[model samples]
Target: MYYGGYYGGVGGTWFLILMPALLLAMYAQLKVTSSFNKYLRVQSGSGYTGSEVARIILDRNGLHDVRIEQVGGNLTDHYDPRSKVIRLSRNVYNGHSVAAVSVAAHEVGHAIQHDEGYFPLILRNNIAPIASIGSRFVWILILLGLVISPFLIEVGILLYVAVVLFQVITLPVEFNASKRALYQLENGIVYRDELDSSKEVLNAAALTYVAATLVALGQLLRLLSIFGRRRD
Candidate 1:
């Protein structure tokens, strides 16, 4: 029997490779929630709402033309480079808490990245659309390849690699953004005590990206193992 026959089998090599990634991803998600909740309760000494903090950072950086808008949903804050706008979630837009301020500043970090033509930021943006479309078709192609043609399996692997690459690029973008946020906050936006709390929130958020990258890597390894067996 071709080793491809064992594809998706339970308690095999696949299980060993995937277990750690799954665990890390779960832990990262929990930590992000915990840190966000904890810091959300702590108000900033600067008493600036998240929107105000974002506006201040943008203006100080000569981004006065950039617009700040309130967005709905939890933790949906983002900087839309195409729109040249920063969209803060409802809580962050009006709340004067450490969590709110840190998140607000982080989005502005992306805006800064765009203004400066950050390499990884630009690469990630270009890769995002391919990864998005590839994600939906990977499993289908893999399953079909298992029964039809090994060439399809190879295509699936290539697509999965692209996704992993996107995740890899995302890590630096997020970390740099978080670092920028902390540095900006430490300058004058928050008191000494509040600085640590903001760090905690950003650090937890960073872990999520780490976990995502790990998961993507693990999945790619799993696919290679399964498909390699068929070739052998």
Candidate 2:
């Protein structure tokens, strides 16, 4: 999830502070899109569809009960810890492309994290609802506080802190998942020569998470600065 919103007309130094992160976010989005599209057309040597690769990895890890389902949309693959199911986008589920398998394996990596009680994933899931609420209403509260009460602004800042925390926690989870995906793919599914391409896809994807964290952090700092100056 990306954290971003306008801070009314209040501008200057804080805006400058946020500029770099905003630019990085844009670059990250372009990088992931380009990498995914580029590799999506390049089929893996193993000829295993994304669903097939996910199934193999799941079963090998003794997660035979874990199920894989095809979902609609582009690059929407994810693992549902509650249902023990891996949901893949149509292309990733049926295509034999490097991008497809790499994405599929990355999602399976989440399932493995769930099974082993990975701390960051566990924490992330636990606070997901709070983070969701924070992301949805933080700006509203802050804007209202600007027009109404300092208390509301303080409350908004506190809520956004949760959103920022969630973004921070997500980094390790994604990085580890990509690492796991590389290991699984390298074993046999993806060719030796194709591994670098696979890494590119995963790394490009990881950059998005990094960008998100930076954006959240920058916004948090901006909020604090705004509040501080308001009191002055």
Candidate 3:
């Protein structure tokens, strides 16, 4: 998750800096949801279920050891690098719709990236633990600094820098996965006419990541502004 701290008492001008990013994040969520649902109702011409498409792509890439499993929740699909597993939501794993295959293939794209040690993906994985900690504790530290010690605010800012770095690093990883996914679908699974719709689905999903990065960046700017003003 590319989440950042919510500075509740910040000046209104600082809030203004974050508002546009928040709006984009909301729009991105709606776009992806609408695109996915609309295409989920439209069956793919190949008629292969999402799981089958995943298997085909994985085998073609010589990732025979990677496994697919069904998980609960809508749009909860992901590829776990540590476990070497691709988890799909029930609808994605069983559905034979255009959206289903597109998402399934996208997760397989991540698997292929992991197998080939894509630099961005590798860097993201390496820093994920620290970034996770930063996102979780950053606000707490900031709030405590306001009441206890200004030094804690500096520490909080350092932690938030890590969170922002993670979000920035994620952009390339996601965009590359979508690129790989589109290529795989165009080769055989998706029909020529259906390729555009598949691209729409993937593009909508990609917007969410872009929006997240923006939100993280906006929040970072707010934090820095406040810290600098306090010092002055």
Candidate 4:
């Protein structure tokens, strides 16, 4: 595995395993997302724009307090937890394709989560600042540990703890988003049959999160393994 054999003192085996796994997940997400976007227009007979669809879903949920605004980029839609707003990218906000509706519905799902107090979402919000703090300094800290201290293990431990915590928090936030997206779709909050491609769009987008989490996890494991062998 790490065959580093105390080369850096840690197996780094986790990286050996993780890098390919990370690539595999990314490939799956990329293919799924691209294909869904490509084929969705064919099934999108609804002709309803993303902004219109967002309005419908929001009003249905009595979420008038939340506003939808158009932003730039492809598939860059997201719910702004801080401002309680939904920002839909150009494609997601205006297109009548399945990709549009599915992404729009998924963003609204976050507003619903905000309203209902989904525990994981709430916990994720609370941890945001803490995680941000760690991520911002993680690389510097890890590198500093390696170069500055004979007690490198302790420094590495700190870095690993921060990284792992960030990864752990990320998992639930994504899983909940996908759950809410599927729930909204199946509940007839958004009529996929009208476009018949909404499900695929949401499914594809969810895979992005899955890819991200797995990649983070693998990297964390590799870091841990690397530091873990320091005493050897």
Candidate 5:
């Protein structure tokens, strides 16, 4: 009878387990931001701006048509497949810091993947909307089921699976981006000195994805445990 409460599930353990990862993610994010800002002030000795790095990288990958444009903000860089544009945040686009070059080059990696039609990247783009919808329903369905019939719980379980699938798919896409960024850095397309710093920043960034996946996995497990306890 006491276990009837949905909170009786793996909620506590799930949170506890993910607590450290969440803390680490926060720390990593802060470190990256601090480092980026710090490097932002250190002018690049090579005189190559973010757009210049992006241009050369895209040209190398035969994505010469992908326009690299500067948008306002910090760390707001991304590659838009729809517009065929690589949008670089103001600081990254115009600055000649290690942060600028690294962030800019990383976005170009996505463009390269698009040009070559990478499978994981393709899968991620396709499933993103479905996953977004599923996430919107997951919490409500799951919590509602906990307070009502077990059937709602089952529905929530199915929905959470969709979210997890997206998380799994994202791992490859992100890792590949970092790998490509590193490759570009090593090839002299971007420059050294910033190599270690870029690597550190990217490494921190990657942990965010890992944290997200782990959170999803925890939720999936929580749903499974709820179902299991219902049976028992």
Candidate 6:
């Protein structure tokens, strides 16, 4: 059997290794969406549009050169460190809800990270291009390794390790960004309940990163196990 050749005696163990991570990823995604939706409906007392909040945060940090622009999509906000631009989704660009502001602030947190040369952020950026290439071809390399050469499997495992490291580094960068967002929000933009709501939103969003890391770790474990079995 092809499975016998590739996976050895642990033919079906991929399911055992990956199912928990897959489920966690799904739950994290659902929680982020639910949290965002809940806060999106709750109007903030500040009555400031998301772009306005971004401007406030950036200006307060002496990031006057950074520009905020509207982007089309849901929960697609990001800071382009290369271009020195912050792009917010339409709901965030125009809406004055806690979710909108919190998300915008979280993105601006990335701008702050860039400006301050945050270590993990810098490391993640340095690894991104290689990780991107690894992500695209790692599976193919693994398949070839399984079919052709045990040495190729080792090579694939090393490449996959790089991808996993990138994800691991990303977790801190994301969580720190959320932390910066909440810190800024607490400086009088939102009151007690509103601050709590923003926290919930940012926390939920951060889980998505956690989920990605877990998924990568699980996949790496599975690959290692399969390789071990193949060697045996």
Question: Per-candidate RMSD vs. true structure?
Answer: 2.9, 4.9, 4.8, 3.8, 3.3, 3.4
Please tell me which predicted candidate would have the highest lDDT against the true structure. 3
| Candidate 3 per-residue lDDT over residues 70-155, each given as its tens digit | 99999999999999999999999999999999999999999999999999999999889888988999889888877787778788
Q: Residue 189's C-alpha lDDT in candidate 1?
A: 89
Give the local distance difference test score of model 5: 0.80
Q: Taking the tens digit of each residue's C-alpha lDDT, what string does model 6 give over 97-169?
A: 9999999999999999999999999999998888887788877888887888878878888888889999999
* TM per prediction: 0.92, 0.92, 0.93, 0.82, 0.84, 0.90
Q: Evaluate residue 157 in candidate 5 and report its C-alpha lDDT on the 0 to 100 scale.
A: 79
Screening candidate 3 with a backbone cut-off below 3 angstroms (N, C-alpha, C), the clashing residue pairs are none
Candidate 5 per-residue C-alpha lDDT over 19-118 given as tens digits, one digit per residue, 9 for 90 to 100 = 7767766777787788778778877667889889899888888886899888977777889888899999988888888778888888998999888899
Candidate lDDT (C-alpha), each: 0.88, 0.89, 0.90, 0.69, 0.80, 0.88
Instruction: Please give the lDDT score for candidate 3.
Output: 0.90
81 Cα displacement, candidate 6 (Å) = 1.4
Worst 10 residues of 1 by lDDT: 2-11
Local accuracy of candidate 2 as per-residue lDDT tens digits, 68-175: 999999878899999999999999999999999999999999999999999999999988988898889988987887888778878988888899999999999999
- TM-score of candidate 3 versus the correct structure, residues matched by position: 0.93
* Cα lDDT, model 5, residue 50: 85
The predicted structure with the larger lDDT, 3 or 5, is 3
Off by over 4 Å in 3: 1-16
lDDT of 4 by residue, 96-155 (tens): 766777777778888888888888678778766666666566666666756665265455
Least accurate 10 contiguous residues by lDDT in model 3: 1-10
Off by over 4 Å in 5: 1-13, 226-232
TM-score of model number 2: 0.92
Candidate 2 structure lDDT? 0.89
Clashing pairs in 4: none
User: What residue pairs are clashing in model 1?
Assistant: none
